[model samples]
Target chain A: MGLLAYGDTGWGDELFFATLMTIAVALVAIFIGFFLAAIFASFKLSSIRILNLFGSFYTTVFRGVPELLVIYLFFFGSSGAVMYVAKIFGYDGYIEVNAFFTGALSIGIISGAYSTEVFRGAVQSINKGQFEASKVLGLKKKVYYYKIIIPQMLRLALPNISNVWQITLKDTSLISVTGLVEIMRQSYIAAGSTRDPLFFYSFAAVLYLFLTFLSMKLFNNLEKHYSRGY
Target chain B: MELMIESFPRLLNATILTIELTLLSLFFGIFVGAFFAVLRTSKIKIFQVISYYYSYIFRGTPLLVQIFIIYFGLGQVEWLRESFLWVVFKEPYSCAIIAFTLNTGAYTSEIFRSAFETIQKGLIEAADGLGLNKLHIFFKIKLPLAIKQSLPAYGNEMILMLKGTSLASTVTLLDLTGVAKHIISTTFKPVEVFIVAGSIYLLMTFIIHNFIKILEKKLDYSK
Candidate 1:
């Protein structure tokens, strides 16, 4: 119990802070992923064959590879890429791509792949008549998208989005490998330093379950709100 | 590129280990999952609750945490170290198999449970009326139908397990990801090494995905 005491003597404070960081990274990655998914979904839905091919290829590659490898590639490769660009501009000292960026970018790319699938299904499910009616009304593409398509797309996609959110949240643990001080990493540090592996890990597991439970409830509520009219 | 060529042999061996780990754990997971699925779908309330909590806890948390708990948490227990269970639990390799098996078992059981539920009651009643033994009915009718119904989802599970095997690298197993990390550290060529590693995984998954699709098509009697 003393091991879980607050402040420097224990890991209570660090674990709490790390839990917050986990949530932060997951939120940022999810937003980045959701944004990219919109583009990918649109590509899949586009009239051009090449765009559809590109979209499928992106999802296939990301979905096939392990998330850990993706994190490693981003963590290790980002610096070299950054340095090459820096040299081209004649500006170089040391540009470390922080673990946060690496973690978020890699998982964001992964989450984007899955979200693309979900979004494509959601977009395809929307009534074609809605689009035709909007076109007949002489509504601009932007207006129709915002007024009709976006709202309905989101309502339909909420269930899947919530599923992806859980996946993203759980995936934040992989970020621990990149040396980010997230919940998993913090617990590892405390466990290693204190030589109390069981307690710390069990604590970390509980923390994760707690986080998952809370997010599930939150998503369920959002799902209810979106499903109100239907 | 030259360094990657030199490392190909080593990477191939690592890939073999990853495949072995995935398949071995998958074998155990399937059996365990099937048993739990029976429990979950059984008439006994206690069995259902036990199966429910097993799947719930395993599925709710991340696999990484589960791996850590098994590897680190179990190691801390002195009684476990002294027990015969240590033969399996003491080694990182065995610990990993146990973790992956249990984790996949939970997910697979849910898949199996749903697949079982989808089997029409009429089919079972017809089998019962034919005077077939329960064992024969389960083997000829229930199992085949459930498996055919569950193949697509099980294919997804296979891919997940393939990806999940990479986590074994965290426990110091020389699986593909672990070997990739090692080569990256020694060669200072993370980009090329990881790209190769990632491509190998992509190829394997692609093969399995297509293979599963072929099997699904072959089993599609309705079509």
Candidate 2:
């Protein structure tokens, strides 16, 4: 098969599928990360000292360590942990967390640490007077967040969070070590199977470039919308 | 505890590899990054656009992806396989250094570019009024000031690079995290190994933070 030929004769098919998995993992991780970050950010913002300390510990430990270490940590025991939880639910059969969930969870958690910082910074940037103003107007917390804080926070946090999202996308490739069939893993597999590491790997790199290009466009548009002149 | 005692030498050995990769790549990356920063802000639109696009692709993408594409991507082609560059590309260590250097370069260049713009116009005018040429002003005044201004950002970047060095494990380089993973595979203690590795990284990060802080103080004293 020719180097660039499709129809499973070359690296083309594998590279394309890998690209899809990469995007899928990135989306999954980012969503989970955003949710977890919001929780931690709120926790950090709360009045309780212990809760704030816990938040501090969470960010310190995760953010301080390397992403690869986190991945290896989770990958080694994630399946066992999942199975243990499953056993409590009256399911005895083996319930393993395959590479996808393992990768997603690790990246999601790592990205969450970063997202927490971004979110905390954004929320903090808003003047306390605004909240005070909202309270004077008899606005509920939920209503205030929805109508005022969330919108403004999005504007403040969009660039930083978008950058974290990009970090998440790239970190997904690290899970190839866990034997995940994501883009990088797929490329690695094709490289080994075809003994043509250079071509397949280069093709996968292009897929990443494509995704990065797409997301940059999204962030720029979002920035424009939140921009003062616009 | 006993296991750690036995593993200390091995772990220490791996630490050397980790440090070598981190320091070498960072030094080289900063050089490349500074170059790109100049290119990015140069008057020529093509230079500006090219540097911008380079940063766009690199900074926008994850380091792991870039590493993978380079490591596996280069191996996929027959032509590259035939090329002399295969000697270096075939090795995991060389490929990792290349990847880390390129990725850090993209980010640090952005730091430089921002710091460059932040140099006060008045500062430039004052230097000009002193009869200093562009080259003299840049080297004697601008560069030093930019370094001081950008140190905190570079501090963060250094810690990131420190952590990012762990990614070299994926390429089979057996750095700290790689050794951790290896130890866990044998000892069946994932959490312990990770905790140990994590602490080491934290120590490294703290060292970098202190180093940058010291540099700032020194720069302050000089002024």
Candidate 3:
């Protein structure tokens, strides 16, 4: 218990901030995933063969590969690729890629693959009659999508989006291997220093469980709110 | 390209280890999953709550954290280290298996619980009317029906576990990804090593996807 005390004596402050860092990274990753999901979902839903093939390939590769490998790829590749581009521009200095950026991007890509499926499913679940009705009323395609299609898609995708968020949040733990001071890494350091591996790791587990429980409640409320008329 | 070609044999051998880890954990996971699933759906409140929390806690945390908890954290336990159980936890391979089994068991229990819950009331009532005892009803009717209902989701879980086992490398177990990481560290070719490793994973998942599809069709009693 004394080891958990705040301030200089304990790791309480570090762990607290690390938990926040985990949430921040997860939020950024999920934000990136939303845009990627939109693009990939549209590509998948489009009738164009090449775009459909590209979309499916992206999803399959990301979904199939281990997330740790994906993180490692980004961690190792991003710096070299950036340095190469820098050299092409006549600057040969090493440009370090930020761990936060790589972490979020890798997790974002993986979550994007999942959320693409969710978004695609949501759009497909939209009743054909909705499209027919908008056309029957002579609405513009833009207006139809803005008013009818997107709203329904968001509503239908909310549950699965929550699922993707949970995964994204957990995936942040893998990013700790890249030296990010998130909950996992923070706990790892604390445990090693204190020689109380069980205490710190259990503490980390509790923090994760707490985040998950809170988000579950939040998502449940969001679902209820969105389902008001339905 | 040449580096990938050169490392292919070692990677292939490691892929065998990866497959071994996935199958062994999943084999044990199924039993643990089934037990918890039954407890979750049982009439007793205590059993139901116990299974609920077991799955809840395990499923809520990341598998890496779970691995660390078992492999590193548990080693700090003085009594457990002195106990005979430490022999199992002493090795990274077994620790990874234990972590993966519990993690997959939590997920599988949820899948099974839903499957069990969806068993039609009439079917169960018919079994009851036929004078089948509780154990008989479970083994004869509930288990088979739940397996059928849960197969698709269980297939997805299998694929997930396949990917998840790659984490064993973090604990120093030389699974497929572990071998790739080793090669990368020595050759300094992360791109080539990962590409080869990633392709192997994709090939494995493709096989699993098709295999599950075939299994689903075979198990479709309606056909």
Instruction: Summarize candidate 3's per-residue lDDT along A147-205 as a digit string, tens digits.
Output: 88888877888999999999999999999989999999999999989899888999999
**Total backbone collisions, model 1:** 0
Which candidate tops TM-score? 3
lDDT of 1 by residue, A1-230 (tens): 89988997888899999999999999999998989898998899999999999999989988899998888888888888898899999987788888898899999999999999999999899999999999999999999999889888888899889889888989999999989999999999998999998899889888988988898898888878877788
- Name the fnat for model 2: 0.74
What DockQ, on C-alphas, does every prediction get?
0.80, 0.62, 0.81
| Model 1 chain B: ten consecutive residues of lowest lDDT | B186-195
- Residue by residue across B1-223, what tens digits does model 1's lDDT show? 8988998889998999999999999999999999999999889999999999999888888999999999889988999989999898889999999999999999999999999999999999999999999999999999989999999999999999999999999999999999998888787688889778988999999888999999999988788
In terms of docking quality, model 2 is medium
**Model 2, range B68-163, lDDT digits (tens) per residue?**
777766666678889999998889899999999999999999999999999999989999999999999999989998998999999999889989
Model 3 CA deviation exceeding 4 Å by range: B130-136
Better of 1 and 3 by DockQ: 3
Greater lDDT among 1 and 2 belongs to 1
Worst lDDT run of 10 residues, candidate 3 chain B, spans B181-190
Query: What is candidate 3's CA lDDT for residue A56?
Result: 97
On the 0 to 100 scale, the lDDT of residue B116 in model 3 is 88
- lDDT per residue for candidate 2 within A1-230, as digits (tens), equals 48666766766676677788888988999888989899999889999999899888889888889998899889887876777788888888876677888899999999999999999999999999999999999999999989888888888899998889888988898888888888778877777777776666666667788888888899999987886553
How close is every model to the real structure, measured as TM-score? 0.97, 0.91, 0.97
Interface RMSD of each: 1.0, 2.0, 0.9
